[model samples]
Target: GENVGLHLPTLSVQEGDNSIINCAYSNSASDYFIWYKQESGKGPQFIIDIRSNMDKRQGQRVTVLLNKTVKHLSLQIAATQPGDSAVYFCAENIMEGGSNYKLTFGKGTLLTVNP
Candidate 1:
């Protein structure tokens, strides 16, 4: 079971700080990785994506680092804000024998922003 279940349900941070979210994957065969951000009662929004061919990818104010040696993934967010408070999830898509891609999602990391 590579699902991410948070030991700490909430994290409080001040605005203008940075945040780091961690996740663990169960399947080693997964090739694609994605990190999503979700607001209160809203659907997850795509933040950034990285393929297995690479080790790290960066986006505007966000960075995703992947370590294939340990099957671990992380999301680094710069500048925390009240609007930045949300749940983050790491997802991986596994390509099986067929053309279909199955995505398995981690539980989530809840980030609370303090003004």
Candidate 2:
């Protein structure tokens, strides 16, 4: 199949440090957003999400910021760890024509943890 999506090439961080990952979305019509983390050889796992009406949302050690005006989204991870090393993705969901909706995902950013 033809390829689709986009992502950052890589990111490097030190253990116990904070890591910030960024993503740019293309669709202004999107109303929902989600951030996901995927370890090697594993499926993408949900981290946090923010609605288009909101600007920021926080989790245990993670935070998601949405800038609808710029169509930009960012994820911040506190206390970076070896286990936190993984690929992160941002996905957007948009609804159209009442029942017609689609979900699109970013290419993903590779986060490397250094001791």
Candidate 3:
């Protein structure tokens, strides 16, 4: 899991297991959050997202959980695999005064799937 204040450069997981990555945001005004997976040199790929109204959301093999009280977000990946190995990031977006907002990213967590 990634730390809130410290950067977690790597996370090792065994194949066929579940992987959980964590992130914390600084802005309580952030209404939207997203999880992204990035391979070595590739761009960040969107995985899942949750709105402030919702506490949890599920995808095919992933889950995103939001805790507004703590300003925390987490991503759970089912059946960890070699292909799932990558750097994961959490991004937050807030719409201010109609349509202007900034997308901010937290320190990434490197996920390493060990066969």
Candidate 3 lDDT over 31-91, as tens digits, reads: 9999998887677799999999999999989999999999999999999999998889999
Alpha-carbon TM-score of each model against the true structure: 0.88, 0.90, 0.89
lDDT for model 1 comes to 0.86
lDDT (Cα, tens digit) per residue for candidate 2, span 56-106: 999999999999999999999999999998888999998878889898999
User: What is candidate 1's TM-score against the reference?
Assistant: 0.88
Which sequence of candidate numbers ranks them by TM-score, best first? 2, 3, 1
Could you tell me which residue pairs clash in candidate 1?
2-26
Tens-digit lDDT string for candidate 1 (1-115): 1222246366778889998889898788899999988876677899999998899999998999999989999999899778888888899999777787899988888888888
Q: Whole-model Cα lDDT per candidate?
A: 0.86, 0.89, 0.89
**Candidate 3 Cα lDDT to native:** 0.89
Best by TM-score: 2
lDDT of 1 at 109: 87
Better of 1 and 3 by TM-score: 3
Go through the candidates in order and give the clash count of each. Answer: 1, 1, 0
Give the Å error, residue 51, model 2. Answer: 0.6
Better of 1 and 2 by TM-score: 2
